[model samples]
Target: MKLLLVDDEPVALRFLSGVLAGRARTETAPDGASAVAAFARALDQGEPFDAVILDIMMPGMDGIEAARRIRALERGRGREGACRLLMLSCLDDAEHQIISQYDAGADGYLTKPVDSADLLAALANLDLPENPLDGAE
Candidate 1:
């Protein structure tokens, strides 16, 4: 799958990239604004991402806002819900989870320090094509 991973922290971005190393073709963004720009560019190029993994906290244009914009972009193109969004956050509270789903239109939410197993499982559960990560170690 083609994936966009957005995280403000360099370490976190690297870790996630490593985790999904061979499983997906990934593009990384340091912040929400860059992520949104990349998303737009990809769509314009006819190479939109299959999924986006967004970090909740950032300096500007947080994940929630980015997600809203992405949804808007998709709707504008008549391609709403075509991209699966997964929220990765340090906030594991119920409120955050609710906001990520209902407010930000995310397909899934996972807490920080996530392992490859949980990440893959979350992605798999998003109604994507059959278990691509199955037996991946």
Candidate 2:
């Protein structure tokens, strides 16, 4: 799958990249503004991401606002809901933001220190084709 992974923390980005290694083609952004620009560029290039995993807390814009803008961009391009969005937050209180995340266009929400299994499971539930962990029993 074509995926965009956004996080301000280098370690978190690397960890996520490692987890999805070989399972997807991923592009990384260090902050929300860059993420939005990349998303727009991908759409313009006719190669929009299939999914975007965004960290909710960032230096600027924040993932929630970024998601709102992404949704608007998709609508502007007549491709609303074409990309699935998953939100991540280091905040333990993030559970309270779940409803807001959904309202902003998130397909899923995962707390920080996210496990590889949980991430994969969430993606699987999104109906992504051939989830690598799907039959790993």
Best by TM-score: 1
TM-score of 2: 0.90
Q: Write the per-residue lDDT of candidate 1 for residues 1-137, one digit (tens) a residue.
A: 88999999999999989988888889999999999999999999999988999999999999999999999999999999999999999898999999999998999999988988898888877765443765554
- What is the lDDT for 12 in model 1? 92
Candidate 1: residue 53 lDDT (0-100): 96
Candidate 2 on 76-129: residue-level lDDT in tens? 999999898988987767553665466688988888889988888887677655
> Using lDDT as the measure, which candidate wins?
1
Give Cα-based local distance difference scores for all models: 0.91, 0.87
Each candidate structure's TM-score, on Cα atoms with residue i matched to residue i, is: 0.94, 0.90
